[model samples]
Target: MNERLLPVLDLVSSRTADSAWLTFTARLDTAHRADLRTARRLLAEFGAPTTNPHEGHDMPGMVTDEELAALRSASGAAFQRRASQHVRAHLEQAIRIGSAEQRAGVHPATTALATKVVRTGSAELTRLDRLDRTTAVNRDW
Candidate 1:
């Protein structure tokens, strides 16, 4: 087991948890509101194992001040668009970090956790895509 991978896993899990928190707190439309709540619950459950005990470590993939401002200020379709983009980016980062952990030959527990994160991320990406398509179709009417 690579000792270095532990921090990576912790960082990825923390960042994912943070993203879920943001999504759950955001004022999303009915289409994604329930999903975000579910996502937050799952993230908190899965990400708990990898939480770093050390303080002051920067959370990777943390939303920038500007992005937070934009999301907070956005409304209607703009908010949906920004949220979608933010979620997609967060999933992508999780997938990448999970892959790295797998490749690093970390402990079986870590590998299993990483695998779960990747699978969850992929599913979320698919759901987001479906939601985007549905929104586009509705807009055509």
Candidate 2:
């Protein structure tokens, strides 16, 4: 999931006209990168298999290749709108997954990371909602 988010973050940062959205994307990028590092460290510490289970699966909140292609062709506000929508979906799905981990995960470190994921993702969702509201109001005026 973090791997998938990196390109979208770069795309949105490059094409978005909204400063707030750009900043949000940057924050997501940083958090996701940290999540990846934590995941790697945990895997090594516990000697768990490092294979990606979701590599080919259609996971929720994962943007499709076609969607990414379209995003690459978009510009300005269009890019921002689509990017925001995709990012919201991604965050929501991540939070759901994290919440599940928190409930059923056996490992202390893993569950702790899940808690952080839920907390951070929820905050990002709130920020995304505010940006949407502001964008809608600006469009109306």
lDDT of each: 0.53, 0.87
Model 2, position 131: C-alpha lDDT score:
87
Worst 10 residues of 2 by lDDT: 132-141
| Candidate 2 displacement at residue 8 in angstroms | 0.4
Candidate 1 Cα outliers beyond 4 Å, as residue runs: 1-61
**Candidate 2, 42-102: lDDT as tens digits:** 9999998899878866677988888888999998777878888889989999999999999
The count of backbone overlaps in candidate 2 is: 0
lDDT of 1 by residue, 47-118 (tens): 654443533333444445466566666554556566566667666776887889778944676677677667
Worst 10 residues of 1 by lDDT: 1-10
> Model 2, residue 29: displacement in angstroms?
0.7
